[model samples]
Target: MTRDRVPHILILGGGYVGMYTALGLQKKLRRGQARITVVDPRSYMTYQPFLPEASAGALEPRHVVVPLRRVLRKCDVITGRITSIAHGDKAVTIEPEAGEPYQLEYDILVVALGSIPRTLPIPGLADNGIGFKQVEEAIALRNHVLDRLDIAASTTDEDVRRRALTFVFVGGGFAGAEALGELENMAQYARRYYPQIGAKDMRWVLVDAADRILPEVGDEMGVYTVEELSKRGIEIRLKTFLESCVDGHVVLSKGKPFDADTIVWTAGVKANPVLADSDLPIDDRGRVSCAATMRVAGLDDAWAAGDNAAVPDLTDDDPDALCAPNAQHAVRQAKLLAKNIAATLNGGQPKEYRHKYVGSVASLGLYKGVAHVYGVKVKGFPAWFMHRTYHMSKMPTFNRKARVLVDWTMALLFRREVVTLGRMRMPREEFRRAATPKRSQRDGSN
Candidate 1:
């Protein structure tokens, strides 16, 4: 592609980094200063922090995601997957939802394609384990869990009831812990509707390979989290791994084998594999290697950030330290990236990225949480409030922020939405069944 006075900026992913970068650039750059284009498989950006609560029905799923076309109105929005990036030619191949693969040329490149769930080669995990990284997955897991409760309440067999009531989550990080906590709280509230299933009948388990969970929240809060979850009757299995889960029979490395219908996997994440196909400087972990200024190493006109880029952590003593792949860093990096891009366009030098690691916050259940921020430790109701307030503030747009706040307010006034819409998964099933003829009618005995 030939360069004009105004360059065509192509952003690869519509996630935290991609969305925020485009948003900032739209506000900073004037009309025709730069033509920004963002591409991703989804039409909206999911605010991942609220996923656990969304799954638990604390927030509406639609409110947690920001529509790309709506928010980035000034920028061109492309809904598709990045098949490959040929930086040598300044071109990218994209396969859209319904069309054949096509190519686009750009003068400036922005790579923000985020990470995927780090899954293992476990036998049954691929078939049974549900991922927790997407909004669709969150809703599916919610329906599946509630359906399991329905099965438990209606079943006559004890084994089936026990299997349906047992829910196992393999990972004790923020995703797993928060999901387990919020879901357990939701399930407990749902138990009031089921006369057959008591609070003691259900089993909730969290398994992690490491000796501790919520490592980012520090030792004291981590200990407190363990104790608090234990009080909720949720078993915390530390230093243990899943040996096998073939056919829904979960066999832990240190526990008795049991059958469970629901298995949620949230271990960790690795950089997007598509980076490997790109002609970019990448690290051993398949992440784009970048300088402290968020520019791709040794390359101009190419930039990377978020979970897919290995940006140096200047605040840490370790020279090789990379900023943790979380929204806290990703959002900040995207903002800086926009400014740097603008500066470079105006013949100004780019600044290096530097930020100290801040503490983390996690919600255990309704009105229960833990946090370690700015060297201060807090837990219980205050921690829960902080967790909500902090994330709400970070949530993009006043539209979503107001919706989530209203959801929380309505929750306090009434009750949390616990009813599951299982039909969403099989919208066509009912019509198909209705259209089918009965055996007697088919046999000419109508």
Candidate 2:
């Protein structure tokens, strides 16, 4: 039971809430009073809302992610996945690459391990579908889409070309809709270089189980978004689910089977599965249960927030109402949680987390978008402008902000980069083939 000289705070996950919460703690606490450590699988925090634009060549991939090491200089950053949380012992088990499981004790723990892609047991999903959650996934998807176009342009087989040109996106939320829109826009522009392939030749389908898309925005704006996307020849399939996607052959609940080389899954997200392994109190959805103050119920010096924690929504009267898992709530919750943690450590009363839902904005390709900001509805170019402006203001650090702005500026003057390096996804495949021994000595031996 030997204790470290300085009190340690272990923050899990380097997402929107985790990074900001650690930053707040470092800035508030004295240099020597407390030590902070952040553990996440990624070495950087991705500003996820900018992912669509980044995938479409509107923003640099690097600019959309903030390096955890460079940003959190005051805190210890561990690049590893948190396997389990031992709340009773105030410790966490981390599994880093090429290492034995190690436990790290903390006086305070912030469970900010964010949500993962909510996947279903639908046939062929695991084999054929790719998620749009991480930076690597985004980059891979961009390259894959462009590479598909290249394949289609060079191939003479109609079936192969059709499959390559056809792109299917499941989930019509912000992630699915925006990604489909931006990539479609980029692919359309790319078709100009290929004399054979035109925008009409490419098929883009967006499928969602919900009746309405972009539920974050109001119904009016959602309708406007659907209209704009439909006008661009992008098919929107509502109240539909992907029944199966076996070997790229997709069968929807309401449509005929179609083969697509690119299938992106962005339907929704659920809390991290790690929560279920811990002794901490969790809700029915496998999210850690926490009060409005962001403290895990019946736990001492432990708090949870972000997508993984089901924080009670004080603003809503429904007993079952919980904060929606979004960046808006995560950012606000992080600030409050940081202050609360700091206060608890310094013998002060912690504050409760509360914030009004402002609104949402979604970019629908180049100059099209839909937004509902503070009950004021905006559509078309105005909404698009607002989407960019809002995200630019929220993007982490001045460096990333400047880099993203520069990316946009260059995009305006130059053609979007359409080149794709699909081989990057499996860079070692060639080596694997080359290393394999071939049968050669049969002439003399046989």
Return the top candidate by TM-score.
1
Clashing pairs in model 2, backbone N/Cα/C closer than 3 A = none
- Give the TM-score of each candidate: 0.97, 0.96
Off by over 4 Å in 1: 1-5, 439-446
Worst 10 residues of 2 by lDDT: 437-446
lDDT of 1 by residue, 1-446 (tens): 23355799999999999999999999988777889999999999999999999999999999999999999999999999998999999999999999699999999999999999999999899998999999999999999889999999998999999999999999999999999999999999999899889989999999999999999899999999999999989999999999889899999999689999999999999999999988899999989999999999999999999999999999999999999889899989999999999999889988999988778999998999999999999999999999999999999999999999999998899977778798788899989999988677655786
Highest lDDT against the true fold, candidate: 1
lDDT of each: 0.93, 0.91
- Measured on C-alpha atoms, candidate 1 has an lDDT of 0.93
lDDT of 2 by residue, 1-446 (tens): 22367888899999999999998998888768788999999899999999999888888898999999998899999999999888888889999976898998988788999999999999999999989998888899999999998899899999999999999999999999999999999899888889989758999999999999999998888888889889999899999989999999999999789999899999999999999999899999999999889999887778899999999888887877899999899988988888888888789988888787899999989998899999999988999999999999998899999999999999889988888878887899999999987767858642
Candidate 1 weakest ten by summed lDDT? 1-10
